[model samples]
Target: MFEYISSLWSQFLSLLSSFNISSALDVLLVSFIIFSGIKLIRETRAEQLVKGIILLLGIWIVANIFSMNMMKTILSYFFNFSVIALLIIFQPEIRRALEQMGRNNFGKKLGLLNKEEEKQKEKKQRCISAVVDSAAYLQERKTGALMVIERETKLGDIINTGTVVDAIPSQQLICNIFFNKAPLHDGAMVIRDGMVYAAGCILPLTKSNKVSLELGTRHRAAIGMSENSDAVIVIVSEETGQISMALNGVLTRNYTRETLQNALEEYLSSSSEPKTQKKIPSFRKAKKS
Candidate 1:
């Protein structure tokens, strides 16, 4: 026991002596990277997948300790094959991660992109006003409408589903697009950088069975689009003329002209902290969809 204790003390002292400012910095950098990776995975679907992988690794360790040849062989084979499977499964997430890495915010922080961002902000306000006005008009007359406003997350996929409008936003134009009997009324509109970017676009339906049966296709599509991206979606129900807004998968309903304007203003403001995404509270809780 004394010999073992002496050996540990000598090793510990050696390690302490070798430790320096450079080593501390190296440890801090590695720790920061690990923490950031955990945060990123936690924010996405990868968290569950990572947890499953860790569980499998634990089981494999146990199997090895017990000398379970059958279990060990199966787990080893599965791990050997999992690399390719994981690449395919996490392609989207991997691409997003790479894109985020490439997007150095130095330019934006130095106000280099301020001109473009400011223009976008102005355009966004215009689009918001047009949407709010159109929604009010539709709600009053019970015209169903679906409008998607893109934010930082590029919505090129969603935009491609519809006819490119590329027109300046106006309440009259938005109302006309969704005028019930209009050709594009059955579809959705996409607003990017405050421009009427696309119309008559088809949106993906939410796969979540959590959506209420009472909701229609427009509301479901809005929720689905919001779930898939960081866009703000507005829906005007045809049947009840109810106004609803969806952001980050949550739907809030019963928005009037003033309240909807306020909600949009609150959410659409440029956040100073670009590292963390922001979630705004709803004006009012809609039906739990």
Candidate 2:
């Protein structure tokens, strides 16, 4: 045992001796990648998968230590084929990560640099202002409104279910679309690339059983859409005039016009800014007796 420990120590020292600037850079690059991957999947369904994978890895390590050949062999086979399994299981997350990477400054400069990229900041700001103004208008009169803001995940499928408007957003235009008596009042409006892409769109209803019974179809649909994609869904309740936002499967309610604008701006600018824990206020409906 002493000899084994001595040999291990010698190997470790030898590795340290060979480490140079290139080795340090290689370690840093790998560490950055791992950190970025974890950050990408944070608070997502992929997080649970990572936990499960870690648990299985622990079991496999223990099995090997104890010479439990059958268990070790099974886990070995599973791990050997894990590349394909990971690809299949993490498809959505992988896509999102790649999309985010492509949207970043580095990727933009590398491949997608254009006038559109240069103008996105200004355009998105205008859209946020218009949406906030419209939400305030609808909230005052208790007129229901559902707006889905497209992010990295393309919402082409959702947009196809509705009538294409493909026009610049304005307060008047948005309010008119959800004016209760309007033709598109009952359906959702999808905002894409800072334009009012579609209206009278059908959104998927949430499968979650834990949603409050008080929430109507619009809110459920908003939550459902958020669950499937990274899009931000803004909702104005017809009954209470409550303003709510759904993101990453979490529904946060009770946003005023000011708060709504700030939240939207923050989330919209997330790609350009350093990520931090910006907690939007949350509220749960009171249960009936």
Candidate 3:
């Protein structure tokens, strides 16, 4: 056994010495492919299938070493067929991986793309300003309103429940929706990709103990929806005529128009940094009278 091991090591060294740069690169590329495949399998239920394949390969290796011709031939065919079978079985995951690769490439090129993004962001800021201004105006007139601002997470599920508007946001349009007898006044309005996507949308209601009793259904619903998503919700109280904002399940109350505008700008600015800082004071943590 020792002599056999020494002979195998000598043969391996001889093969290594004979390898060209192209062969070395091919080996490195294959190593990376194997590593990535293992990682992908580990991340998904496909690991079980991989284990089965590995076991089959191991059996084949042992069979070939032992001169079991029939077993070697059968296993080789199974192994060859598995490559095509895996492509079909993991099609969705493969597509997602390719999409993620494309997104990463796009992100790397973002410096060149940022000018266009900035223009779109400028447009969005104007829309946000309009929404905030509309909410403030509505608050003064005691017009109840619910405005949902989309973030990283898609609000497609919520948007599907409401009437699709797809209109450019304006103060007049928002005010009209929440007017005394507007048909869509009863439900929330959803904004997505700088457009009002839907109206009269029913949002989930928040059940946070931290939420104040002074807050009505609109505020609770706003907090609820925001908690479930990465959305920013602006609520105008019909009874108290106050402006409030809800994010990540927390509500901030008594926002002046300027404060609201600044909060939106700070939160919505195109910075890629993760937001850990609170944009507004928590309603529960307000100073005692």
Candidate 4:
């Protein structure tokens, strides 16, 4: 045992002596790429698929170690064509990652704000106020509502799924759209560039098991939409009158009128105006799904 340990130590020291700056840089780059790929698949269905693939790989290794010819052959054939299979299974995740890479954040990075940009900021501020007011009204009456505010990623495809109503947002208009008796109340409303771009739009449902089962279709849809794009989704419960927001696959709840406005402004505004770092309370209670 001591001789074996000495041999392993000698090999380790030899490996360390051979390592250089280029090897260090190569290792770092590979590590960063792996980390980025994992982060890209983190909260989506792809995460589970990845785990399944890793398990299969481990089993294949074990089969090889045991010289199980039949098992090794089957696993080898599966892995031989795994590249194409993986592409088909991960198509949505790949598309979303590419879109995120190409998303237009250059202006924000360069801090460029022209006259038209300033006007757009004003419009978004007004829209935020109207949305908060309508959410407050709906929460009081226990009327369910789902409003999606588009950000860097364009939601043109999603907007096409619903009836277009390109009008400036207003508290009364928003409330009427989500009224229980209204025709569009059952679907989602898409707010684009400070205007009500569409209503009655259908959103993809979340497939993640991480979400609480108590959440309803609206909350799941909100989380799903957030997972697919860089949008902020506001939801008001029909039964409990609780307000919630879904962003980047995380749902935060218990937002009052003032805090809701503050949160929206912090997310949507591009102005240089300083704002308070008010902490919006998180999801405090279990919700129905």
Residue-by-residue lDDT tens digits, candidate 4, 13-76: 9999999999999999999989988887775678889999999999999999999899999999
Q: Tell me the RMSD of model 1 versus the true structure.
A: 4.3
Which tens-of-lDDT digit does each residue in 1-66 have in candidate 1?
A: 999999999999999999999999999999999987676566456767888999999999999999
Per-prediction tally of clashes: 0, 0, 0, 4
lDDT at residue 21 of model 3 (Cα atoms): 93
Residue 239 C-alpha lDDT in model 3: 93
Query: What value of lDDT does candidate 4 attain over all alpha carbons?
Result: 0.85
Candidate 2 Cα misplacement greater than 4 A, ranges: 40-42, 55-76, 106-129, 151-153, 179-183, 203-217, 223-231, 247-252, 261-289
Cα deviation of 216, candidate 2, in Å: 4.7
lDDT of 3 by residue, 31-129 (tens): 998887665555344666667877888999999999999999998887788879889877744653553344233453455547878787877887788
Model 1: residue 41 alpha-carbon error in angstroms: 4.2
Window of ten residues with lowest summed lDDT in model 4: 273-282
Q: Return the clash pairs for model 2, or none.
A: none
| Residue-level lDDT for 250 in candidate 2 | 69
Q: Rank the candidate models, highest TM-score first.
A: 4, 1, 2, 3
- 10 residues in a row with least lDDT, candidate 2: 279-288
Candidate 2: C-alpha lDDT: 0.84
lDDT of each: 0.80, 0.84, 0.77, 0.85
Candidate 1: residue 90 Cα off by (Å): 3.6
